[model samples]
Target: MMTHPPRPLALGTALMLASQPLWAQETQELAPVLVQERRTVLPSPAAPLHTRTALPVSVAAEQSFTRADIEALRPRDIFDLMETSLGMNITRQGSRINNFSANRGGNVSFLIDGVYLTATQAQRVVGDIPVGAVESIQFIRDGSVLSILPVMGFGSRVSSPTQGVVVINTQPAPGKAAQDRAQIKASYATYDSWSTSGSFRHSWMDGRLQLGGGYQHAASQGKPDWNMAYASDTYMLHGGWKDPDFMAMASVFINKGEREIQRYIGVLPNSSVAVGQLNSATWKYDPRDTQVFTLNLARYWNGQHTTALTYGRGKADGTAWYYATNVNPDTVAGRYFKDESTDLNLSHSIVGEQNSFKVGAQRIGYVQLTETLASAKPAPREEEIYGLYFTDEYRLTPAWAIDASARMDKKHISKGGDKYGADGSTLKLSDDTWTDKAWLLSLGTAWQINPTWRLSGRYAYSRTPTPDSITTSANQELPDERLSRWELGLDAKLHPALQASFTPFYYVIKDAKVVDSSAPKIKVFNADTGSYEALSVYTSAAEVIRKGFELSLKGRFADDMLGYEVGWSHFKDDSVTADSGTVETPKNRYTARLDWRYGPWSSTLSALRVDEYCHYFQGACLPTGDFTTVNLNISRRFEHGIKVSLYGQNLTDKRYYTRHKTGNGQTVYNLSDGALADVGATYGIEIGMDF
Candidate 1:
């Protein structure tokens, strides 16, 4: 058994210092002090770097969360944090693996400081980062053109047509003074889980140059019979320099972890297995490691023009172990894989009197190799992508604006591997290559209806390449997926202390890809077992229509001491096929949060409700019951920068299970018994300090 070290008292002291100006102003005694502070805190006069294009007007729905929000929510993991956003859903398939969907079966694109990441890398890196290390998170629900820049790479595109994007920024804003500070946090929770982290930041030259680093470790011995023990360690280092004309930032992140696949406690209704018997393949990732690096640079040629460049690299290696049924130790197999990716982007922006224009180019490359117990050698797959794009925003008047964007992307893929057949026979595949190109477009407009109201609308068309599973399994190329969407939004200041927004959206997708488990089984050779196995077949649907609406209200009252946020999202999908169905996404979801503060004490309460939805599995639609959960956090802040908090999740101890998408693109439960229940009520206390 592994145990955490002893806890320490939360005690720290912070000192504040102010600098005097070299020259004093005689007009007023405070003028010089104010001027000096502004100069040090404000950004340079040059145009700042634009990682992603920003819309001139609020034509799309977007949600943003600050560090304060994160602290109040007290989320335990990335999945918990993302679930707070509207129209977003997270389902965990393994301890560190998850599926993210937005707006009714639409895939999501993920970015970190404008650096694009593949789907696999996103899951591995983002899930490992400590919540305290994140400075902010933004969710773009309707800006397809602006969000599509990251997916134009050779790396795995969104598995399905994307309806949203999630951007994470880890760098924190510089403070008012050049200072050095550190933070330490630790907590213990149910199931013998423990988490600990430490971080520090140092600034120099009037806060113009800074360096920061952190390390985090977490482990848990899950409930008995679940076999879900997990452990991970993460390290991060970042540095940046800023000046009037030039800026540069670089960061490196590394994570290593291992998790055992969970098991079920009961048998399915139609299964022949014994009653009350635990069932599932015994599987685990013995060891997995991933590393990521990014560099960002910007040159402000003038106040009106700027050039920026961003580069990123990622590497991952892992080994998986599979044991015979009943966890027999004498018989086992291993599968090993390695993946690497590189991405580069360059852009120039021009600011005119009434218009702004941006042009950019990007290149991305990826390589993967895999070896199994029975394979003779490692198989290799490689890809390269090139993209060019342009965007323009014109202001017709101070009260109205219009924006347009266009992009062209091309990708080339080469693959050589051992193809297995029905009777456990292997066929060596030659180097096969394929190339594809696509174009995307978007148009948007906004109008100020009145002093307190605004209206906006946007239309966008996007396309993505078919998934690798379908292409590789079929041993051929396939038609790309395409989608078109329209969204309308209205924002209103209903009261002096309240704001509200309403959005309605519609989407149409062509050649939607899916896996049919009930269809004729495709026989595939299992390298580890040296035997043939039946697997799900992949197919494409002609079309799918999805429509949804979102409503949200946020405000502060009681002299800013009490704040609240409430949101509701509803969506339904219809597939144009008699035997096919889309049921992974719930039709109705509701979320609410309330914050209260009085002097040094504060509390936050949040709730989520998801309506029951059918899951398409094995040609049948099974009902997945609805569930509701509540989380609460209470904290006290001391004058010396010390904070202590108590947090609890699923306070009611409700039991529920979520549907997840499998590697084969099929929707199914996490357990072989058709049920993977959530970990019931858990409580923990955490303490932290800054100096």
Candidate 2:
């Protein structure tokens, strides 16, 4: 191993000291096939990158999440992990189904390398909980935007390709100390359902090459609300090779992921009838099928400069419905939609005076092949997008810095439409193509603020299109989507080991494509549209958030008799200039946790509360609901790496849904009966030995 002396940092050089290794390609003999595997420790614990924590904010927990972060969290499910992260929020209409929608703040966008994973298909967004398959996640704020990534328009959606980027790395380096790792989990909930999975990994070649995979089978949900009760099986495959000049990671993900909820779900208005509600006999969702492939490459220019490239492909197979008799039933019903795409990107980094600049470009194209139940012809629709981007970061001082980026994109939507006469006399679909060329620009600055604080604010403008799954029409909307965002934050060192941070942000979104009418499937073009504001605060020293505030007390309180932490935040949002007044935003939320340890065992109790959030849109207002839940958890760590844990959610078994968005586009009360979850209690045990 070679190590360089600590060098003086330079301006335009904040991005240097990148991962650069000499290609040990084919330098060693082949070894027996091995199991596959999956942060920068901040010099100062308090100075986390961009304060992005969301609400129910705990004033006592200040730790951020990363690939290494999730391992300790032992998240009960994917939803729990995401909700605890900063700058990211996934809204849910009910616990039974996560159909509401998702959004991330500022320039925060999720990615598998440089590819856009969220826009691949319909109802395929909830794929969190990577199962220890995550690599290092690099959170890049609008430092650049690449076409291969998801469209970045205005709205609460995550945009600005990496003003800061969070790249979750699932591959682990090879090493010999005769090292090994294994993870196994089994869980049982109500409805006689259960799930179990296990994964193992071994490292070699100093962690240069790693391979790993996992399989899961869960007792299906036959809950009264569910249409069918069937077991689900999922398998994960991943592999990777790493060296100086060449590095690659590829995966083949096959999961039998499907769910059938009663068509008439959630709290609904009395006016709506169960015309086509999904029931035991009729409700169906073509099991979601997805295949993911990705590759990453690096070419070193010198000891001080390195360039890298990434590529990915994904395909989704499923059947969607026409809720309001919208999607021409014959075209969308019982149809097979194959969303497949290829993404490519190349990035270059160079160490400059006191800083470093990294720039890259990406392009993505998707082919949507559909076969309607009514149409014998399996027509094909192609969507193409390309982007060019660049970013520079200058380090002014060891504790202060600045970064900025710019990008441009061209999008083409090719759909086969019936012939349309140029004059308004005939009503026909035109085969004419629609292409949108847009330029996205953004800039950001990070300040150490002080010895105990760091602050960053960013502004970005982009012209991307809306997602097709949610849009009412195939006709592309060429309008530019513009956005403006501002964030100001403060972090402080209350004591030698105690830290706290507070950030308040403002957002303006416009040119969004939303369903104007459910009947007949009509879309209306609206401009300069919605606006939202958010505030987040984090205070934790513990390695995990769900562990509550115990981590902070030990860090600051130093294992005192009583140690605790509290987090609270406020998020209020609504239409900036629409007839609809303030919509209920779950943003107004708060959380507090207190944990104590009496020798070998520990107990944690947490309280979570959410202010009224927009549940249904009706009348001249958006109806909302409120939620408050309490949870209790207990765990024990024994000698020789053995552990046992137990937890209970909604201890009071509060009869409340997370959020509501009913009324079938009209105003109505909805219970989301299918989602009415019973106050749940869970128990689990783990046994491990480190030899």
Candidate 3:
């Protein structure tokens, strides 16, 4: 089972081996062309999107969700696999749902072709990326941000943002060594809504350089005050080149993404929070253009050491703000805003005896400028952040290896506005240069205890950045948002075709930030005074801890092509109430997904459950109980890049909220248990083609 690191068969095997317990199967190396960037530049002349088992970690995991062998049928996103893997659950309070991957989405980081694609969306912005366009996705669940993997902040924990790299090959180019393919997909849902997308790609010599483009649009219908209209478009241009001497990939997206949020909460007019909903509120993140360019240069020097230099530049310009407010039913409260950022990145990796180490640096300039009418005043600031990180991986033994790394970021508010405590107020504060620094450490061990069995585990200590408001001395440096995480687990091979893993983990968010901001200059005051200790663009200086267990199962009992997988997880956040002094966790969440394939038929089944989730507004919760849901998908495959899929979600019409109740009484947490759930079911018929 020795892998050459340059074979398609080994690629899939590597993915399977890295994710779960390895099976007893012969392995082979991939074609020379396949292992090189040149392969990606060539087309298979069979499909639109590159359909292969070999892909980098950044691509989404397709077989995990689309395979039908051991699966029933379900409709879900690629991230949904984590739901079942770790008994994870997603709660949608309003229109947006936070999609977590393996590890209950805890400590998950996202990347597209090595560029970090991390942004806190005002609301759930539907990305028009076609699932079929994905080639393969690599994941390092419960790993470290330094593990060349993704890790998200623990839930409700205040931590600075971090990112890993992701690489995607939407289409293969022409005249190259790799296969080129295009993918077109169309689907219509229950609300007379339909989504259409098309993607094209081409390549150059030996797949040294690849070019790809894609576009997607989806639209639907709704009621009067509850009108629902969502039509969005995204255009992407991506290219990559890999040679013995250099490797580079660049991508840009111009998106006019829009969404019409229905006033489903208007019925609860008693809660003025609903006031914002009835206003035909439309949120459009319309990014005129977002671009990311990455270049990697590596050469084998004397075959003993590898020298590499990586550089990246990214820019994002778009509108980022909320329009209507429940506090003010009038249109005067709504206004447009702007958000823009520019960043540069560089890294170097070196090889050593039985060990490899890498170090990198990043500089980012961010600006939040409001785009208001002539009458509007400016409340904008420009800030800069400098970050440095290093990682090391060791090959202790063929059976057991170890990985460790750390990173630090120093952020400076080169410029910002002065703060006034208010008229005769002692709380007056001035803006000072703010700096944030972080560190991360991780250890991993993978032991092939025997030929038929293997075991692995990981534990990490990581510190991310928090908001400047969290640390101040009349104006002090921002505190470092910190997280202490430890994960212990085991993988076992019951047989060759069957595998299983159980991982229980714990994480603590120290000095997590609590957001409470205000602008007293204008007579407008936040009535929630006690909670309104202070106002800031971002805030959190509290401590919160989260613990959970994750389980994964997948085996091939049928033919070799048939794939089966099932996963489940349980998560809870323990806390004590301020008044009653009772210990409780947000909720007990669970998820289950099964996928199997037989012949051309592939089906999947998924389920999600959250126990007694408390929704507090102003300081209240909706109710106590288990909120559950189910989804299913069925599809068939054919030759020449053409396939159709039938999918149904929320089969039981279980209504649930994507968000938790955070406010208090007068304007907060009083409501029916599942008032925010999407109770109705949605089904869609999809047609896909690649080549």
What is the Å distance of residue 274 in model 1 from its true position? Answer: 6.6
- lDDT tens digits by residue: candidate 3, 572-673: 654323221122333455555556677888777777675665443333444533656678888888998788888887787855444433333333333321
Candidate 1 vs candidate 2, TM-score winner: 1
Task: Give the per-residue Cα lDDT of candidate 1 at 566.
Answer: 94
lDDT of 1 by residue, 18-58 (tens): 23333533232442111111111111112232555354464
Candidate lDDT values, in order: 0.70, 0.45, 0.48
Rank by lDDT, highest first: 1, 3, 2
If scored against the real structure, what TM-score would every candidate get? 0.85, 0.70, 0.72
Top lDDT: which candidate number? 1
Backbone clashes in model 1, listed as residue pairs: none
For every candidate in turn, the CA RMSD to the true structure comes to 9.9, 13.2, 10.2
Error of 2 at 69 (Å): 5.4
Model 1 lDDT on a 0 to 1 scale: 0.70
Worst 10 residues of 3 by lDDT: 42-51
